[model samples]
Target: MLSFILRRLLSGVVLVVTISVIAFLLLYAGGGDIARRLLGEDASPATVAQKASELGLDQPLAVQFGTWASGVFQGDFGTSWFTSQPVSDAILSRLAVTLSLVLGATVLIAVVSVALGVLAATRRGWIDGLVQVVSLLGTAIPAFLIALGLVIVFAINLGWFKPTGFVQLTDSFSGWLSSITLPVIALSLGGIAGVSQQIRGSMLDALRQDYVRTLQSRGLNRRTVVMQHVLRNAAGPGLAVLGVHFVGLLGGAVIIEQIFAIPGMGQVAVTATSQGDIPLVMGLVIATAILVVILNLFVDLAQGWLNPKVRLS
Candidate 1:
């Protein structure tokens, strides 16, 4: 187990390096100079050169990448062009908002999706039809559309929930929950649909296995057979997929944050891009890429743990 973990960690380091190199080249190679973009079209050449040199943008690409990557090891994500603050600090400051949304949506997706999936699978006639219809509606509706509808009905018409903004949990628990409700619902809708569909298929497949028949022949109640034998076996793949979804929840927050105006990493990225904040953009891209790679590694490890067959291989 230790050896496996060490191997994965080494691979993760290599992946992060590759991601950093690619991000650096992409940002440096694209369009106008970042300093020029920030300083405006009418800026003097000397001013541009000074700014570029200050940010080390005039350095050779390899040297610049090396400097940036080295700083990353020390938790410095360079300085934001907009605020002149460390990009790492900016991202970390907003990390809580994104984490709250991701965690809330994840819990909702897991509970609701698995419950509906299992119930539908066990009662495969009318119940299955109803669940499928609901899941289809979730999948069919665009996230922006869902956010809009939620705002219109819940925030404007009924005034039951706030349409936008975040309230820190330390400030007010009620306000925090109220502010997150819409974004969480929007984020969870697609995940719920996907997870439910997958779970339904998994459970059905588990039911067809020989062990399930043996349990049934022993006269075990349907509930017992499902909760004990079927759910355990069927959950291996679903759980694995859940890890991937958790990673996606972070990336997909971009749209949800924009619609709701939540100050998270997604919002940071959007703000940076609009302002042509190259440092912030590059930082976010690298951070997000590292997040994805780490989450995928975790998923693989978890799958191997849950299924001994994977570990053996």
Candidate 2:
């Protein structure tokens, strides 16, 4: 198990490095006239040259990447070209908001999807039909549209939550929950639908296996057998689906944040990209890559735990 963990950690590090390098090239090399944009269109070529040189944009790609990566190792992500905020500060300050949304949605997806999946698989009647209907609706509707509907119904009509703007947890825990409720629901609906379907399918397959029949023949408690063995086997595929949904939640937050006026990594990412803030963009990319790696690592560990026979090496 220790070796398994170590191997996953090593692979995660390599993945982060590879993503950072690719993102660096895509943003720095392909991104045009960043210094000029910062200095404004009217700035003289000499002034732009001075700014580029100062920012080390004039250096060869290898040298620039080396310097940036070195600084990153020391916890310096440089300053935003436009805002002049430390890139790390800009990202970290907003990271919490995005994490809150994604994490909340993830929990909702896991609990609700699993329950619905299990019910549909076991009951195989109206319950199954209901799950299918919900899955269809969730898959059919766009998240943004759902978000808008939620705002209209829950926020505007019922006044259940604030339609836009985020509340910090430090300010008021209840308020924080209230602010995130609609957005989390919007983000999780599709995930729940997809994951529940996958879970139902996997569980049905597990139930039909020879072991399930053997357990029944041995007069084992049906609930125990299904919960302990069948569900365990089914959970592997469900977990894989959940891991993917987590990433989707992160991407979906971009629109959700914009619609709801929440300050998060998504909002920062959009602003940084539009303004051609390479340092901030690079920082966001690295941060996202690291987050993805960590999430995958957790998923791998969970997978290994659920199925000991899974070969980590």
Candidate 3:
């Protein structure tokens, strides 16, 4: 298990480095005049050149990357070219909001998916038919549309939740929950559809295995055989789907956050990318890469724990 974890960690390091380098080169390759944009359209050519030189834009790409990479190694992501805020501070401040939505949605997706999938796979009657219909609707509907309908139904029409804006958990737990409820629901719908399907398939397959019948023949009750053995074996694949969906949730949160007016990385990432704020954007890219690696590590660990074959492999 330790060796498996170590291998994953090493691979994660390589993945982060590769993502950073590719993002850095692509942003620079665009050849956008960052200094000129910073200075404004009316700035004289000479002044723009001076600004570029001062910002080290006059140096070769390798030198620029080396300097930035060195700073990253020292825990400094540098300042936002536009905001002048430290990249770490800028990103970290907004990260909580995005994380709140993503993580909350993830939990919802996992629990609901498992329940619906288990029901569908085990009983497979009208309940199974209902799960199938619900899954289809969820997948067919867009998240933004769901978000809008939620706002209209719950916020504007019913007055249950606030239509927009996020509340910090530090300020008020209830307020935070109320504010995020709608967005989380919208963000989780598609994930629930996809993951529930995966879970159902995995569960059905596990139930059909010869070992399951063998275990049942050994005097194990239905619940005991299903819960202890069948569910455990099915968990690995469902978990893999959930892990991938978590990444999608992060991305989906961008549009949801924009709609909800949440002050999360969604806003920061959109603005930074559009404005060509390399420092801020690079910080975001690196942050996202780290997030993916961390999630994958967790998924791998969970899989290894659930199935020894995974760890051995």
Candidate 4:
């Protein structure tokens, strides 16, 4: 297990470096005058040139990348081109909001998907049909549309949740929950559908296995056989789906955050991209890559733990 973890971590390091390099190059190569964007449209050519030189935009591509990479290695993500604030500071400020939404949606997905999937697999009648219908609609609907619908229904019609803006957890736990609930639900709908389908399929396969019947023949109750034997075996694949879905949720949160007017890393990313803020965008890209790699590592570890037959090495 230790060796497997070390290998995963090493791979994660390599992935982050590769992603960072690609992101930097792409943003750099994309046509844009960063200095002019920072200075303004009315700035003279000479002024723009001076600004670019001062910002090291005049440096060769390799030199620029090397400088940025060196700073990254030292835990500095560089200052935002527009904001002049450290990129790390800006990201860290919004990280909590994004994390709250993602983590809440993840927990919701895990509980709802597993329960609905298991129930559908075990019941195999109207209950299963209902779950299937819900899953179909969930996967079919776009998350932003879901966000709009939720805002209209819960925030406008029911007055249960705030339609926009976020509250920090430190300020008020209940406020934070109420503020994030709609966005979390919007982000979770698709993830729930995908994960539940994966779980249902995996559970069904596990139940059909010979050991399930053997356990039943030994007089193990249906619940015991299903919960203790079937579910455990089914969990590995379900977890894999969940992990992928969770990574996607981070990307999806950008639109949801925008629609809901929530200040988060997603919102920051959108703004940075539009304004061609290279440093901020690079920071977001690296942060996202790290997050994805970390999630994959955890999923791999969880799968190995659940299924001892699975070899990590």
| Candidate closest to the true structure, highest lDDT | 3
lDDT, candidates in the order shown: 0.85, 0.93, 0.93, 0.92
**TM-score for each prediction?**
0.93, 0.97, 0.98, 0.97
Number of clashes found in candidate 1: 0
What would the TM-score be for candidate 1 when compared with the true structure? 0.93
Q: In model 1, which range of ten residues has the least summed lDDT?
A: 304-313
The sequence of per-residue lDDT tens digits that candidate 3 reaches over residues 62-179 is 9999999999999999998888899999999999899999999999999999999999999999999999999999999999999999999999999999898888999999999999
Top-down TM-score ranking = 3, 2, 4, 1
User: What are the clashing pairs of model 4?
Assistant: none
Q: Which segments of model 1 are wrong by more than 4 Å?
A: none
Cα RMSD, model 3: 1.0
Residue pairs with clashing backbones, model 3: none
Instruction: Give lDDT tens digits, candidate 1, residues 48-156.
Output: 9998999888988889878988888888888987899989888889878888998899889989989998998898999999999999999899878999999999999
Worst ten in a row by lDDT for model 2: 304-313
Please provide, for model 4 over 65-158, each residue's C-alpha lDDT reduced to its tens digit, 9 standing for 90 to 100. Answer: 9999999989999998788999999999999899999989999999999999999999999999999999999999999999999999999999
Clashing pairs in 1: none
lDDT per residue for candidate 2 within 1-313, as digits (tens), equals 9888888899989988998999988888887887888899999999999999999989999999999999999999999888889999999999999999999999999999999999999999999999999999999999999999999999999998899999999999999999999999999999999999999999999999999999989999888898889999999999998999888888999999999999999889898888788899899988888888889888998999899877444
